[model samples]
Structures are given as structure tokens and as C-alpha cells.
Target: MRPATDLAAGRPAAPAPGPDLPLDGLLRRAAAVAPDRVAIRTPLGDTSYADLDAEVDTAAGALTAAVGRTGAVVGVVASLDVPFVVAYYGAVRAGHPVAVVNPLMGDDALVHALGTAEVAAVVAPPRVAERLELLRPRLPKLGGVITAERLPTGLLPPGERGPAADLDAVACIQFTSGTTGAPKAVRLTHRNLVANAAQIAAVHGLDGDSVTVNHLPLYHPMHLNSAVYAAATQVLCPDSAPTAAVTAANRHRATHLYSLPVRLAALAADPGLGELRLDTVRAVLSGGSALLPAQARALSDQFGVPVVQGYGLAETSPLTHCERPADPRPGSVGRPVPGTDCRVVDVAGRFALPTGERGEIQVRGPQLMAGYLHEDGPATDPDGWFSTGDIGYQEADGHLFLVDRLKDVFKHENWLVSPTEIEQVLIRHPAVLDCAVADHPDPSAGAVAHAFVVLAPDAGPLDGPNGPAAFVNGRLPYYQHIRHLDVVDRIPRSPNGKILRRTLREAAAAAPTDRPPGDPT
Candidate 1:
């Protein structure tokens, strides 16, 4: 690993979205509409629309000179920095496909992504070239690698980036959901993003005036596809400031606050939350993981903001169903948004069953991904619908409630352990940040439940950090209790703040028992 100082020197920052709006029109317009207005706030500093957009032009100019051609594949190897924004849009506007790979990934995942996508050139953080050295023997297809820290020396001879890019044009390639092994590279076109944005907008009545507190990372579909992109386009009524989380609604006075189940639980539990002028926030939505019904009810009751649970996979372009404000159901994932179709099918997989039946949940919609990049797949049957792999039931009212993963639900002895059930109980404990339930082989019982917990940062562990066992045994019935524990220093999270379950599962499997989580204070 390299320090920030070792990376390439900084180039001029990129621009925010603006006029003649095409691929990156939002920042341009925001520049015209609110030049002095803060466009994005990070831990670093706030960026005004005008300043940000100008840097975007610089990045485009620099990237255009270096690449020498259109329709090329460009890989970016940087963290969530301001330059990532510039390079992302500059490449798209300049007519190149952008493939973003997590710097944190292992060798196999990286080599597969680059080779599978046929990436010709790479624009990465400094020292990224060194990282690519390992790829030489494996990835024969890869060509030149450019460091974002080093700006191209000169300007290009002037060429058009073509007509304004459409919602249907290729925007970016994001990897999600294959954490157990090879993660899938989801192809999100401009159209799918735009369509989903429109759905969110129409559903929520978003406009130019709205603001959303963006606590999530730029990688998740909720943050990247929905919150940031939608907000920039004024499609889903967007506003995002990174600093707003600590300030509460007291600072930005944001209209929407997007959070995961864990964050929402913490925020709602905060006594100071109600003191802020959050009157403008119409509703709060949670996704990436399931929220316990009790957690859902607690947030709604405390904030006076309806807590709606949303469900979808990275394969589905991130969101297919969200609870609308008008007809709110506390635990229901609400109904499908416009342009989406849903149904519950039986185990054999053919006939659509009645509403009350619990089976595999399937969805079909325009917002679905272009498909995973590496593996040969469209991931659906002859028809357009895709199976969610999750087992759930659709209520007579059309609301969807998740049961357990068809594969995740297991029997220990004769009694079945529903991970979702035990997780709900474990999460309610004040010390637990997030938990994952998996089954390990048990010679006596056939299979036993293994709970891997991530504790809150502020709470010192019963052993050290991530120590979940000491407090777990007395909390739940033995049949469903966690038999093993691993206290990691920190849980691995996605750019969007999602728990990387595949990583946790691998770590757990490698060392089923370590220092016992000693005890919980």
C-alpha cells in the first residue's frame, strides 16, 4: 500500500454538471443555476458548481489529448477523490468506456475485470502502474496505463466528443454482488440510470430545489445511480453534502436523507435528531440490507419521517421497489416502481403463484443491468425477468416482504435457523453494528449457525474489536446462537458503505475460532 503523498501529483480538478447537458449536463446546469452554490461536499472541502465544472473541462482536455481515439476502454484506479469525478465524466464525454475497479480487490478479481472488459488503457492513481505490474503475465490484453496524478502534457488538435450523450449510451461499468467469489461487473447505461432516476423523481416528486444528505459512498447504486446522479440531473430531486451527516438537517436543511438500515437506526436513536429543522425531509429510505421491522417502526416513530424498506440487487440496476409516501406500509418493500414488473414463483420455477405464497422473488424492468461483464450471461430465462434468489412473499396488497435466501435458510437438528430472524434480534442490541448469519458443519447437529458481527466503532470490544461472541450466547436461543466469532478490527465496506459479506464469509471460514470475544461490557 502507498501513502497519499506517494501517488501522482494533482491535476486540475474536474467540473460539476452543466449546460448543453448531455452525459454530464447536471453539473453544467447547476453551474448556470447555482454557480456559487455548493455542488459537492467531501471530507476534503466543498466544491462550487462552476469551479468543479471547469476542472471537468480540464480533465476532458487532458484525457482527450492522451488517448488519441474514441471508443477506447479506460480503467481508473483511484479512491473516492475529486479526480475520480473528472476522469469518470471526462472519459464518457470524450467517448470512452469507464471501468472502475476497487483498489482493495485481490489479484484474481482485478485481472479478471480488466481482461474480461478488454480495457485498452488505464487512468489510475499514482503507483497504480506498479500495481498493474502483477497483471503483465495474466492480462496480455491490457495496453497503456495513465496516472491521473500526471496530466497529459498538451492539448489535442480539437475533435468533437459527438452529440450530447443519451441516457442509453454507456455511462460506466460498476461491479457488485459477486463478493463470494468473482463479483459481477454490472453495465449501467445512461438510459437505465435516467429511467430509474425518472422513476424515483416521479415517485418522490423531485425537482431542482431538493437537497439530500449523502452519507453513502459514490459506489453503491443508491448513492451513485440514484442519489448523486439523480440529484445532479434534478431528476429525483437531489441534494448531497458529505458533511451534512454531523450537522444534522441543521446545516444543509436537506430535503432528503438517504441511509442504510444501520445508519438510520443510529440516527433515529439519536436524541438530537428531532431538534433539527428536518420538516422538509418527506421520507427516509433504507436499502443494501434488510431493516428489522422494529428498526423500521422505531425510525418512523422517532423522526416523523416514514421509514420505507427498499429491495433490489446490483444485477437489477440497484432499485426496483421502494415505498412511496402516499400509501406507506412500515415493513413492506412497497410496490414496484413504474416500468417494473414483479411476481413470486414456486420452486419448480414455472407457474406464478397466488399473492400469499412465499417463494423466489423475480423482477423485470427497463432499469435492469446490461449484464455481468466477465461471465457469459444475461442472467435471465427466455423472458426478460430475473430471479432475485431471495425467498419472499407478495402480500395481497402487492407489498413484498423478504423471507430468507433460498440457500441461506438452513436446518440445525430439526429446528430451522432463519438468519434474518436472528439478525433482527442481535442487531437490536446496542453494541452490535451489523451481523451476518452463516451455517458451519456440525457433526452432531448436521449444521450450526455462525454469526459474524461488526460492532460500532465507538464501542470497545469485549475482546478487542468485532468481538461478537461473548455477548451473543446469552442473547438468543442455543439453536440459533452463533457458535463461532471473529473480531475484525474493522468491517470491510463498499464505496457505498455496504458490508462486504463475501469478505466476511471468507475470513470467517478461514479461521472459525480465534480469540474468544472475551466478554461484552
Candidate 2:
């Protein structure tokens, strides 16, 4: 492993708050300091910090009455709206670990997530509530389903608070995105959430004066917690159109713009992009997946602001590294955030590798999770280092560059082939709007790279000599060359914007041998 001194060389220090603060205390502190500040703005309405805090208190009281016990898990469907924010904080304030359920999940996936968490109660919007009503029989432990409309009625006394929770106790449970395998429930403590909030706010340079635009389908806790921790204002934009988010940012005079890589790529491709003016926006931030360097450069050049990205998983409070806004790097996720240590280890063994060598990324930090649900103890080694299962490399100065998921990498002729490496080259072609790469079985070579591409609207024939296949193959080595290429209207992605490689790989394996070929082998 890299020396401790080397890892900590230029990283910032931990936030001012100690590790003892409760998760709900983030809202309380923000409300106390700026009670009248506009905390959130949505198309429906606006909410002040004082009003939001009071609503959380009422919701907490109601949840206390509904759950009838402390420490029971509460499932909260995480939609990007004001009620979700209330229920999420309310559950934590009521001394319950809130299991954040993605509202877009299918019935079986939803049941699996809630069942695995053993959720005793759930707070959801009307749609999710209706679905939960049908699944309640499967969840015998579930005692109640509270809708957002009922959260403000205060079923119990308004001032009632649950028992004080320990800082190290599990405060939130987030299931993985399941892009690789079955989603696992990750347990994050109050300390982990709080520390990460502070770390994110510090890295993003958020303060009371900052305003942010969240243009996502589901509200991620990382963005919500960090905004509350910094007492910054948030404008929730539910519209999926890339231009709508930009318009919202301009309307709110937002200082930071947070979006997914998929959305940003769309924004980069939008013809109206050149006409939009992000006069007040300082930075455009993306996460959940790597934003293509070409897309990032397009946005940076158009808006005249830095486009930054970060890296983390559900196991690490969702944030470990964030690119510096002032000095953004095009293709790097930047160094580890304050109070975090990251190193690359050999994939087959626990031994650390030298700088610039591709290996599994392992992380150690205050923001790491306690463990996955049903696990015995913290999911780390004796020394507290957690293997991230991501293949990456770090520069001598500590900037991390992701190669691909370790499991997603396949071998061809005994040589490891990174799908992302091929995808990156494919996307650089002007005609290729988006793309995904997966391995197809081969008797002699073990596996060959198969690519699925979404072409630009005005692009011409793809099977010609100058097609994407020839374009990408010319830039790659023999083993990494694209063997099969298919054109699709869109690439399949999870709700959180991760490319569904498993799905694509399945399609590739089941494809007929008479399909179109890429380059003349």
C-alpha cells in the first residue's frame, strides 16, 4: 500500500463536526442557524428551513406512533420531492434506520429490498404506497404504510422524540444499484453519513449562500445530506429534459448543478445547449457513472465552467473522491476526499500495487459503512480497509482513473480486456452517441468484445468501411478490437444511470451467429 504520509499529502482535513453528531442533527443545525432560509424549492411549492424542520418533527412523532418501537427499520421511497425529504429525516429523527427504496424498482426488486432490510414500516408517496399495500402480506414484519399526505397530520404528540441514538449506530440502509448482481443492503452509521456530508460540502465549497439544482429521478441521500449540512438551498427539478435542468439552474441562480452522466451527455447533445446561458452556475457536477470525456469537454466549453465528477459506492456513504471544481480533470475522479485513504491492490490478492498499475480499488475512511445487512461485523479487514471491487489506477499525485468494474473485465486470448476502454474509444466517434460493450463467448479466444451503439440521429450507414467498428478497431489493439457491433435506439441503464452490462452481456450471448460483423477478422 502507499505510505500513509503519501496518501494524506495534500488532502484536506476532516470537517469541524466530530463523529458524535446524529444524522438528524444536520437538519436541526441547519434550521437553527437559518430558520427562515428557503431550504427547498420545487414546482409544487417552496419550503423554509423552519417549516421543513417542524414538519419533520411532526412526521417523527407520527412515525414513532406507527412503528411503536425504537430502532425498527423504516422504508422510505426516495423520490425527488419535498415529502420524501421530510419522511427521510423524520425516520432518522425517530431513531429508526431509514432504508431508502428506489421508487422506480420493479415489484420483485422492491419486495426483495424491503424484505432484506426487515422494514417495520414505510413512508411513501401515493403510487409507492399503493404498491406496498399489495406487497404487505409478503412483508409480515411490516406494521404500517404511511403516505406523505399523512406525515403532516401529527398522529401523535407533536414534540415527541424517539430515544437518542448512538452515533455509530446504523442510521440509514441503501441497497446497491444491482448492475452487477443482486443488490445488497449497505448499513451506514450516523457518523458515516454526517462525516460524508461535511466532506462533500467542503469539497464542493457549499455554504449558506450556495444554491443547488438536483435534476435526478430519485433523490439521492448524498446530495440531500450535504445540502442540509451546509445550510445550502436546493431546487429540485423533476424534469428529465437536459435543457429543463439548465433552465432551472438559471432560474434559481444556482451555484452548483448536480446531475447524472447520462443526463449530462444528453445536455451536451442538445441543440439548444448553445442557446442556454448558465450565467449563475459555477460548476456542473456528475456522479453515479463516469461522464465521457468528450461530453464533459463539450459542456465545459459551452458553459465556460468546470465540469467535475466523483466516485463512490453505496458501501462508502456514496462519496469517496470528488474532482476539484477549481482545477477539474477531464478523465479523472480526482483524489480521495478529506479523511479518506484510497489504494489499488492486486485483484487476486490483498497485496497493494504500485502507482499507475490497474487493480482493485480499496478504500479506508471515516465515511466507510459499518457493514452490509445480515453481516457479522464491519465489512472491512482487520486494518479497516474495504475492497471496493472496482478496477482502477492512481497517479503518483493520487488522482484516481477508473478502468472498469473488476467483474466486468473479460479475457481474450489470455489478455484482460476492459469494456470501458473499448467504449471510451467507441464514443469518441462522432456518429456514436452512446455505447456499451460486453463479452461474447468464443471457443478459441475465451471471449470477444461485442459492442452495442446508439448512433447520432443524422448518421449514415454503419456497416460501411468507415463505420464505428472500423473507427474503434483502428484505435485499439488486436485483442481489444470490437468483434461484433449492433445498433440500438438506446443503451439499457439502471434508474440511477449505470449501464446495465449484465443485461447487454446476456443479449450478446443469446445473439445469432448471422448478425452483422464489425471489422473483417
Candidate 3:
């Protein structure tokens, strides 16, 4: 095979992967590398590469028949089993845009997306089918609703025989948070996802020997591009992907696990680790939510695997900065992966700044999402550097340290504040359990710091308002300290456990504060 540089330099003898290189090609390459190896292991059973290939062919035939046209949107709302992968590849095989919808989303959000994106055919499991049925009256353009359990006994469309793909053809559509307003669909082309996969794979040394142990929900970016697409050997998709994760590792002899911090905390706290015979997976990757730096160090020593952090967002095809296993910076997302150029910039999107300066993060690479579905948004700049809306800075050594989400930062007595920094310090408190810090609007200052915390069971009767407020007030600078607080059973979280600060923000906007009329507090 010619070197990638050969293609980059436009040499006459160099071979371009070409616009025709499709998602199926990735599966085909995997087949070449390990034709008969075990590829997907679920609670039901294990599927080898040869079996997976056959399933792809059969499912493709079924998917082609179901869609039967060029301008069709295929939806997959099944559980995270091999069939979902089979159906996804099958849609790509049928040459149609596939939208991977969340099985957990409510009927209203689901209906809004379907209406806005104009889905033609939807394929879903029984549970998802129930929700889709609720919206059936509202969706006028919906051509067909098919269940994952059953395939139609009919012929595929003749037009389903896909010709060469245009690199810009929309392949997948993922949605952003609708909290600010209505959710927007992110358009990703075949080349967009494929190129991002190549960059992620190249940077991590992902190859035929890499066994990815996945438990993350399949809809997330880290789960898709970082774990599934970048994996070289196989992805073990458990029935209860999270609860079954440790078991799958032992069963499949997995070499890597890309998990969120909640999972990592559970694994670290597992009583089975010291007594039970466990699999010898080589690396444990933690991201999507904050992974406590202390947890990284402790898990490394206990489990005998280094836990590394990675960073990215959905718009950038998920991965841009990844930690290298050979030499790691545990708290930092190691560096920009090959083929990706990342930098920190001011809100105006000017020139790149020096390392260690907090600013909005931007990335330019082959893997960026094509654009927001048809609305033409400002997600990416003319230079191809997409604004991640995340705040962080690159270290002098090239490692990236994530500060916080841009939206998560708020004004605290005229100084810009990041909740992550305060939360980091707050978590270190003995009585404090899960902590979330946000800005509560104040009369004198635009907003003041507010905290909600969970206390450890052992800590007696001190989890309420004054308990955490007093602790933070003494430890932090005057402006940085939280002035008001509430005790909650737990922090509101996403299905994945990323802190739901927006929910807290919304509640703050509704509540009345007790502070004096002109006080910043």
C-alpha cells in the first residue's frame, strides 16, 4: 500500500481512496484483516466476521426493499445489538441517508425531528415503534414504518443499487441539544465520517489487534466514531451494555474499554476486582463527562490499566484530541490526532493563541460534520475550523486540558467563571458528594454562583444549604465562591450522567432569591 503522504502530495502513482469508498468498505477491510474472528458479542450470542458479513448482505437486501428510492431517510431505533450495526450498514449499502434516533427520547422531540428532517421510512424495535405510532398522525411525509423484528417480504428498489457516492452526499444526520431552541440535525457525509474514523484510528494505533469493549449508548459520538468505528478487531455490544461490560471484557478478552466517568467509578468500586479473576484488558479510556484525575491515577494502580481521557463533540465527528497509550497525560486529552488541526481562539475566531490560555476550542479536519442539516448554521468557519462551543486550552507540550462548556460558564461578579473549576474543588470536600455549580442571576451583579450538592451517606445532617455554602465560601476567592445553594437527592443528569446544568439554570431563572436588594450575593 502506498503511504498516505503519497496521496496527499498528489503523486501520479498515488491511489486515492476516492469518493466511491463507502462505509461498507470499512467492513470489507475488517473482513480482510480478520475474516473469521469473533466480531460482536451480545447477551444473546457471539457473531463472527463471516456471519456479520452475511447478515450485512441479507439486511442490505431488506433495507433496499424498504426504502426503494434515492431521497429517503431511514431511521434505526433498535437496541444496541449487532442488528443495529447490521441495519446501519445495510442503509448505507442501500445508498440512503440514515438517521440514528435515540430510543429514549420523548414523542414530541422525536416528532419534531422527523418533521423537520422529513424522514421517509423508519426502522425501529417494538418499544420505539410504540412511540413512533403516537406521532404517526403528525408525520405526513413518512412513507413506511418497519419494525426491527420483522422484514418485509418484497423486492428492493432498482434505484437502491447505489452508484459511486459524491463525497458531499449526506450520510448520517445527528441532532444537537434543542434546549436553546429546537434541536438542529447535523449533516455528515460519507467522507466526513470515514475521514474522521481514519484520523481517530491513525492517532490511537487502532488496528487488527485492538479489541474495543463498549458499554456507552450507541447514539453518542464517542461510542460511534471513537469506539466502534476506530476499533480494529471487534466491538463487544452487551445486552445491558453497561451492566454487562465487565462480563463482556472477561468473556471476549477485550483489550480496551471507552467509558464515561460513572462507569469508571463503578468499575473502580467493584468488589469483584480484588477477588474475582478478571480479564487483562490493556487500556481504559474515560471521557464524554469529566473523569476525576484522582480516579485515573487510582484505577491505573488497582486494575493494572492506564485510564486516559479524550475530548471532542458531535459536530467534529466526535474525536479530535485523544490520549496516546504509550505515553499518557492522564488529565489531558493527549493531542490533536493525525489529519486534525486543533487550536484555541477567542470568541471572534481570530488567530490561534499560545498554549495554556483559556478560549473557545476550534478544529479543522477531514472529519467535520457536513453542515447543520439544511439550515446553514455558523458551526464551522470559512477556514474549516468548527467552533466546538467548549472552553479549553492546549498545554505547552500539546496536550489539551478541557476547562468547561462555553454555555456552562457564567458571569460571577464581573469575572468570567467556569463551573468545572469550581466543581473540581467542590468534589474534594469530604461531606460533598455529587456537585453541580451554575450561575443564579443576582440583582447587583448579572449573576452569582449557585451550587447543588449530594452528600456521602456517612456525612451526618450536613448536606443542606448552609453546609456546602459555608465550605465553598471559605475555600474559594470571594468572586469564585458560591453564595446560594440547595440540597438535592442527586444532581439532575443526562441519560449518560453528564451533569444537567441547564435544568438547574432553568430552575434558578424561576426561583426568588433571599439576598438583599443591592447585594451581589
Candidate 4:
């Protein structure tokens, strides 16, 4: 590994163990431990732990007064800015559940989130605030929009609040990415967020001294809560450019680098990559989607730092398994963190499978959410195990390798076909830049694999006999072959970087066939 140095770094003090506290308590504890230390470093400025705590208190008073009561749901536009962070914890501190909304959502989707969440007030950016006004007629529960600058403050005296909040109360309502359908709100309690934050900190080996650079498009609660729980400093790199992110980490002597899989792949493919260095970065972490194993190895080899990935959903406080830095695995998402149990269940969803047997993955843990918002009850079974709806298998050594989503898998002539497995193989082709496979309806075969491919810019078109469909067919088994192919410029992806397979499925099903008779389809 390349040598690292810390210019203005000091060890962060560890948090003391106690009863399960609310998510906002993370900021308070960090303040108590290191009041003068820098808690957040943004491109514009830095905020000390003490100042951040005070701001939260101030913002809490403003938010509570604006909402007019406790327990009101506040919709927060989750921008990767300092204001959003203050409002997120502030609303929670005032005894209200915060629903984090994607700022990039369309007007219709944003209206849906606000109306479904039943938010009394919204803390949003200037642009999103205007959009909320346009959507206000559709959202009956929405009382008003509160800008970051206009929140009421100084109503509550400093250091005069009551005891730690009840752990069972819902702290935040996280919505799932609606790549396939409408988003569902996951009700997360103080206990759920706190437990997962601790679990993440422990597994990632975070200490007060650790400095993480966040380059994701939006602020994720997993990164926010974990950093606060460990009293670690976080540097926000707002730039989407891969080299810019690396430069920010190097500038701050950041110990951890968090990013999305799409950005990492671009970083690995950058021609100017050889000029940059990550001397202070300990590890590069990817999530939201699977990072290509080849890209992971390339980045690790070039930077002399491990490139690791993790697995989870909004329903599980977003973390269950993570690759270990010490003995990193290239393709696996690594073992489950402390206090989490993972098992593979057969297609029937009743029988547990042996190691290496592919099945639906299920998990039970303290980090599990309380329930879905406005739903009857939690999705978990009576024993607290929640089926993840993901098809994968566990290894003897405990690593998890995800094959594909249960809904995305299909059967061809009594043989199960994994779209992800085929996509992985297709991506290895010399001309293929990215690809997605979906089942196309057929008269005899029931369904056949169809591919949507994005070729490399310089790579010549493979329109002849040696195209992707033929190339992939030669490599994969008969059941896993790509029956049809369409070249596209780009693959549609959600804001968080997950491929929109549902979109591809519709396109593939609509395309007319041009092949000879008795082909795969």
C-alpha cells in the first residue's frame, strides 16, 4: 500500500456505551466528546461538533414551532448540502419523524412522496421549495415549505432538553428506489438506525480519528449516522468527477472514500488516472449497485488501496454485509456485520439451503426497520426475519454473492436463468461497455434472454455475425443465451445508480424480431 500522512489530524474520542439513543444523539455525543473538533468539512467551510450541536438545537426549535406539534412528519429534500443535514437531525430532535425525499424526483413522484408520507411541512432547497408549491394542491397534508434560512430558532434554551428519546419511536421514513414500481416507505426507529450505525462503525473499523470523503450524489443516512456515531470527521466532495473526488480525499488526507459503483467504474476507465494518487486513502467503498470485479481489481491495483462493496436496502437501515479491508473479496459483499443473521431460503421460501445453493436471502437483525409507513405492520415474519427478495447464496466462509433479484430471475425450459450472471458475461466482451438482460416472452420457450447493450465509444459496431447475441451465446449455456440484441447509447439508471431493468424489459418485449427461423428465441 502507498504511504499515507495526516497533516492536521488528531485521534477522535470514542463514544461511551449506553441505552439505545435517538439518531440525533450521535451529534450530541460527538459534541460532548470533542466539542472543538471539526465534525463536517464541506467545500465552503467546516463546522465544529459544538457548533453543529447548537445548530441542531436551534433548527429543532424552529422546525417544531413551524410544524405546530410533535410527531408530525416532515419531508426533507435530501440534498448533499449542510442545510439538509441540519434539518434532518433537527426535525428528529423535535420529536417528529423525517421522511427523506430525493431532490431529483420528478414533479409527479415528488407529489407522490409528499402526499403518501403525509408530511406537515417540508424543508427543501429554493428550487425544490418552488416545486413543492406547484405540487401543494395535490398534497393535502403538506402545511407549508420551510427554507433553511427561515426556520425559527432561539426558542429553546441550550442544554435544557429532556432525556434521550424513546428508542422505539420512528426517527426517519426512508423510501425505496422505485426502479421497478412505486416507492415504499420504510419506517426506521431510533433503535434501528443507532444499531446499524454501530454495526457499520464496528465492521468498518472506524474510530474518532477516521476521516471519510463522501462523493455520492446525495447524502446517505448510512454514511451520516455512522460517521457521527464514531465521532469521525466527514468531508463532502460535491463534484461527480472521479478525479475530483480523489483530489479532495488527498487534499484532506481522508482515510475512507465512499462512492457509487458507476463513479468507480468511470474512475477505473479514466485515461488521466495514472496522474492521480490516493496516498492517504485507506479503502474505496462502493454501494447502491454491484461494482464490476474487474473495475474493483483495477482500482485496487492502481491506488494500492482495497476497493470493497456492501449490501443492504433502505428496509435494513442500508447495511448488513460489507467487505473487510484486511481480507477483501473481489466479487462478494462480504459477511454480515455484528448482531445480524443471514440465511438462504429455497424458492419455496420455507427451507434453508446449504452453502453454495442459490436461493432468496433473508435476514434478521437489530438494524431492521420497525415497519413500513402507513402500512398495517412490519414486513418481517413473526420471528423478525425479513425476506430481502434478493436471490443469492452464502459461502462456507460466510461471504454473500448476489446473483440477481428474485423478480428478475426467469425460467427457460425448466432451467432457471440469472440475468445478472448473463450480464456479467456479456460485459466481459471487448466491445461491450455496459449491458442489461431481461426475459422476453416467447411462444415455445416461455421467456428468452434479451440484451440491451451500450458499446464502448471507440469500439466498432458489432452488427455482423460476431455481435453480442452471437458472442454471448458462444460463452453462456443454452438457457442463459441472449436471444435478441439492441444497441443503446446508455442504460437508464436510478439516481442512486441501480439499473432500471424494468425499463429494459419493456423495450425488449416491444422490439420486433429480425432473425432467421429456429433461432434461440
Best by lDDT: 2
Ranking by TM-score: 2, 4, 3, 1
Q: List the RMSD of every prediction in angstroms.
A: 10.6, 2.6, 5.8, 7.0
Query: Of 1 and 4, which scores higher on TM-score?
Result: 4
**lDDT of each residue in 1-521, candidate 2, tens digit only:** 44223342224445434346799899989999999999999999899998888888888888888999888999999889999999999999989999999988888899899999999999999989999999988888888998877786333455467678799999999999899888999999999999999889988999999999999889999999999999999999999998999999998899999999989988998988889779899999999998888889999999999999999999999899989998787799987888888888778666777778888888888889988899786588887889888999888878899999988999998898999999988887888888999998877789889999998888876766688888888889989988888888899999877889999999889977654445422
- Per-candidate TM vs. native? 0.73, 0.94, 0.88, 0.94
In model 4, which residue pairs have backbone atoms overlapping below 3 Å? 62-152
Whole-model lDDT, model 1: 0.63
What's the lDDT for residue 314 in model 1? 68
Q: Where in model 3 is the C-alpha error above 4 Å?
A: 1-20, 152-161, 177-181, 219-231, 235-244, 271-273, 276-278, 461-466, 516-521
Answer with 1 or 3, whichever has the higher TM-score: 3
* Total clashing pairs in model 4: 1
Which one wins by TM-score: 2 or 3? 2
Better of 1 and 3 by lDDT: 3
Candidate 3 lowest-lDDT run of ten? 2-11
TM-score result, candidate 3: 0.88
Q: What TM-score would candidate 2 get against the native?
A: 0.94
1-521 per-residue lDDT for model 3 (tens digits): 11111121111211212224566656655656677766666667777666665666667777766777764888876467776777776677667788877776677888888877788888888778877887899998877788876753233444444546566788777776554356788888878777777766666666667777777765353354433344354555544433467677777777877677887776665666565434768888877777888878867877676788777766776677788877788678877766677777775445566666777887777777877877755667676668788888877656888888888898766688888888888777777778888888887778877777787777654535445566666677777777666677999876556787888888777657886432222
Candidates in order have lDDT scores of: 0.63, 0.88, 0.69, 0.84
